[model samples]
Every structure is written in C-alpha cells, then in structure tokens.
Target: MAKQSIAEIRKKEILSTFYEVAKVEGLENTSFAKIAQKLEIQPSLIVHYFKNRDELILALIQYNLDQYKQIFSIAHADDLSHQEHLNKVLDKLFSLDWNELYDDGVYYSCYTLIFRHPEIKGKFKDLHLELRSGLKTILEQCTKAGFLAIEDPATVAHQVYNLLDGTYYFVSMLDVKADQEKYLQQSKTLAKKLIGLH
Candidate 1:
C-alpha cells in the first residue's frame, strides 16, 4: 500500500508538470523531455508510467477530471438553504481571482483532441454529462425550495457551463485590467436572472 501510494503521488506530480509545460509551450510543442526537465526528473520516469504522448494526454485528462470532481464535494448535500447551498457551489465555480480552475489553454487544447483523435470523445462527453447532471440536481433543489423558478434545470446548467467557459476564454486571452471581477459578476448576475431569483 505504501509503495502504491508513492507511485500515485509521483504520477500526480508528473501529470501536473506536464500540464504546466503543455499550457506554456502549447500542447503540440510539448514533449516528455520537457516535462521531465521541468520536474528535474528522468524522461524515462514519465515513459515508464505512460508509454507515449497520447497516453500521457489521456492520463492528464483523467487527472484533471478527477480534480474537477473535488469541487462538487464542497456542495455538502445537507439541510442547507438553497441560497446557501448554491453560494458554496458558485463560489468555487466563479471567483474574482480565479486562475487555476479554468485552465483555459490546457483545457481547450485537450478538447481539440476529440475531433482529431475520436477515441477520446467519450471521455469528454461523459465529463460534461456528469457536470450537467450535478448542476441540474442542485437546480432542482433550488426550485423545490422556491428560491429559483427555473423549469429546465438541464438547459440552465448547460447555459451556465457555457457562460463560465466563454468567460474563462476571454479573460485568459484579453489584457483587460480587473476583468476577472467583471466576468465573475456578470456570471453571477446572469445566473440569478436565469434561475429567476432576481
């Protein structure tokens, strides 16, 4: 168990290094040697775990999706009010100083692979469905609590995801000062409108 734990830790560290390097250098330009150099480890170490570039990319995608799953844990499906419950969800979803969560470059680059690599499409499809269902569940709760009047939680969830994605893309590319706060506020306001809360 201890050996397995260490292997898992090393795998996570390697994947994280790859993610940073890929985002900075562009995924197409990234190589196992670059990730190894970034982590100051043997390139063979990465190859030992992941046979090649495509394998590593797939592993990183799974790792990122796993990290995203952690966000839902903050929701705490208990007796909390709809507003309170949704607040916890929204806070993680959109923060003024958020940089890490969106992972704009890395995420978008991986998304492009679904078209080129076809086999990877199911992974993304499942992830989006998971996110949509989770949001829809929370939205259903809000509707039951009488705080939100949304009739189609599924559609609203997709809209909210798109809003976040688009905002992340714009914020990452543009050099607008204080744009993060503006984007987050815009999302929050629009969410309220969509749910008919305000």
Candidate 2:
C-alpha cells in the first residue's frame, strides 16, 4: 500500500484528538486550542488543516461516520461462513461494542446539527444510506449462498439498521447494565425476525 501523506497523518491526528476532547468537554464547548493543547501542539496547526470551527465540526461528523462503518467490517472476514458472518454482524450491532467505538455525547451532538446545518444533515443522510447499502450487500450475499432467503435485501437491511439505531439511542439513556442488555437482546431479536431468521 502507498504511504499516507504527511498532511493526511497530521489531519488524522488532529481529528482523533478533537474527538477525544469533544467527548469530554462536549462538542459545543470544544475548541481548536483545546484539541491542540491535548495534542501538545500549536493551535495554528489545527487551523491550517481546518479553516474554522465549522470546518472542523464537519470533518468530525465525517470522522464519526467513518468510525461507525467499522461495525460492518466483520462481514468481509475470510474465514467465516456467510451465516456466521451475519450472526457476528448482528451481535456487534446491538452490543456495547458500538459505544466503545464512538462517544455517545459526541455522536448526539453531531446528530443535532441536522436541525441547523444542511451540509451536516446531508452528510448524516449519506452515512445512514451507506450503512444500509453495506448491510443490504451482506444480506444479498447470504441469500445467494443459501444461508438466507431474503426476497428484498434492501428493505430488510433498512429495517434491521433502524432497529439497531433506535435501540442504541434508547439504551444510551438507561444506567443499568441489565436493562441495557435486555433491550439490546430484544432489538436483536426483532432484527432477526425482520430478516426471516428465528
């Protein structure tokens, strides 16, 4: 693989630090100075990569989408059968592993941007569409492999994703582990039912 450019590496570093800082400080409260200080670099370095706070925020939203795509990555694992891969994808989708991938605070903060920023809203819509498309591809493969008999993989994919998304949002509000697990399992069950699985 070709080496990453210096600018690419620097921007990634800045975005990662910005995410961490935003998680702790809240996205509205985070600033370039805070991200730079966390990275132990000059604030101008961040500004050089991101022209303004809005630019940084937009980039961060994209970063959030990228992080979420990690959930479906197991679908490409070479060793697993299609059935096993789909199970793993479903399990990961409803589990707390997603919470570990990205901060809830930061995610919801960016989500709220859909109300005020058309660009952010468009990016978020793309993110959801891409996720649904990925899942649909996986379901289509399972159908072709005889592991599933989905007639409309695209519709099933959308339904499963909506189940996962809504479940996570509700689960985030509950403080008890047992309660969270109960809801997650319910969501997973519903998702399986949607996909014609038992």
Candidate 3:
C-alpha cells in the first residue's frame, strides 16, 4: 500500500472530528471552530484543507458513504456457504449494527440537504447506487450458486435497499427497544419474501 500524504491524513482527521461533533451538536450547530477545538488545532489549519463549511460538509457526506459500506463486508469463513454469507448480509442490513456505524441525527440532517444542495444530492445518490450495486452483486452470486432464485438481482436489490432505508429511518424515532426490534424483523421478513426466500 502506498503511504498516505500529510494532506490526506489531516483531511481525514478533520472529517472524523467533524462527524463526532456533528453527532452531538448537529450539522447545523457544528462549526469549524468547534472541530478545530476538538482537534486542538488552529482554525486556520482546517481552512487550509476545506475552503468553506459547505465543502467540509460535502467531504463529511463522502466520509459517511465510506462508513456505510462496512455493512456489505462478509467475513470469509470456510464453513460458511454462499447462502449463509448472503443471509449474514441481510441480517446486518436490518439490524441496529448500522447505528454503531454513524449517528442517525447527523445522517438525517445531511440527508435533508438534498433538497437545497445539488452536489450533496448527487453524493447521496452515489451512496445509494453503490450500496444497491453491492447488494446486486451478492444476489447474483447467490443465484449462480443455486442458493437463491432471484430473477432480477438489480430490482430485488433496489427493493431490499429501500426496505432497509425506510426501516432504519422509522426505527430511529422509536423510544422503545421492543418496537424497534419488531419493525426490524418485519422488514427482514419482507426483504426475504421479495427475494423469493421463505
């Protein structure tokens, strides 16, 4: 692997701090000074990397997309069959594990910008496309392995992705754990039905 440049390292550091601060204070409330204070660096250093708050926000959304991709990763275990691997992916998709990946408040706050910011909207579209593509690839593999019978992996992938998107958004608002689990299981069942699974 090639070594990371200083600029690359500093940018990631700034984005990571911004994410944490945003998670607590919200995207609208988080400022460059807050991020710089968290990093114990001068505000000018942050300006050196990001031209403006909008630029930093865009970079943070990309950072979020990178974090969201972790859900698709499967642990390579010799004992796990293709179907088992796909099952694991679906489980992760519907589970609260995503809550650990990023804050719902920060993500939804950024999502609202799609209406006002075309660039943010495009970045979000890319995030969705990449996620669906990953799911489609896994579904196709399962079909070829005879573990699934999806006729159109792309459509099924899109449906499942939508299911997860709606499920997570709704579940994020519930104050009760049981309610969240109930909806999550229901969504998973719906996803399995969509893919022709029992």
lDDT values, one for every candidate: 0.78, 0.90, 0.91
Winner on lDDT (1 vs 2): 2
Per-residue CA lDDT of candidate 1, range 56-133, in tens?
888878876776766577645586777888877777677643456547678888899999786577788877778778
Better by lDDT, candidate 3 or 1:
3
Q: Which residue pairs collide, candidate 1?
A: none
Q: Count the backbone clashes (under 3 Å) in each candidate.
A: 0, 0, 0
Highest-scoring model, TM-score: 3
Tens digit of lDDT per residue, candidate 2, span 115-152?
Answer: 99999899889989998998899999999998899999
Model 3, range 140-176, lDDT digits (tens) per residue? Answer: 9889989888889999999999989989889988989
> In model 1, which runs have C-alpha deviations exceeding 4 angstroms?
1-4, 73-79, 97-99
Task: For model 1, give the 10-residue run with minimal summed lDDT.
Answer: 95-104
Best lDDT among the predictions, by candidate number = 3
Alpha-carbon deviation at 65 in model 3, angstroms? 1.0
Residue 97 of model 1: what lDDT?
Answer: 38
Candidate 1 TM-score, true structure as reference: 0.82
User: Could you tell which candidate, 1 or 2, scores higher by TM-score?
Assistant: 2
